[model samples]
Target: MTTLPQFALTVLGLLFCAGDVAALALLLTWQERAPSPDARRLRLLRGVLPASALLLALLLLAVVQLALL
Candidate 1:
């Protein structure tokens, strides 16, 4: 029972981070034909990177807690 939240959070966080990375990769490719990426896209990437980092940190914390249990 105690493990349920930890497990769920870990899985969800990983999925979120993975999706963010994939999106960022796809967005980067969009700049290949241009001299620079659009300002809007850059702003979006900036927002996503921080969110992914925070989620990854949470996921790591959850894994550590699960291991300690």
Candidate 2:
């Protein structure tokens, strides 16, 4: 299968980093308005999980890009 070039992967990583920051801000804002501890935790997790996943994915992409080079 074809793979993305290192430069492209690097750009994608940057974009993901920006997205993660935004997600964190939104998560914190949501947490402040949450009604209960359980609800707060759930909302925080909901915001965090996807950002974490994206970070992991970006890490993997970097690794793959390195391997290709």
TM-score winner among the candidates? Answer: 1
lDDT of each: 0.62, 0.68
Model 2 Cα lDDT, one tens digit per residue, 1-69? 335665676677667667756766775676779899888788668865676677667756755665665
TM-score of each candidate structure, all chains considered together? 0.48, 0.45
Worst-scoring 10-residue span by lDDT in model 1: 27-36
Model 2 weakest 10-residue run by lDDT: 1-10
Q: Report residue 24 deviation for candidate 2 (angstroms).
A: 0.6
Model 1 root-mean-square deviation: 5.5
Candidate 2: deviation at residue 2, Å? 13
Once all C-alphas are superposed, what RMSD does model 2 give against the true structure?
5.3
Off by over 4 Å in 1: 35-69
Q: What would the per-residue lDDT of candidate 1 be over residues 1-69, giving only the tens digit for each residue?
A: 768886787677667656756765665555444555685566556754576566567656755655665
Clashing pairs in 2: none
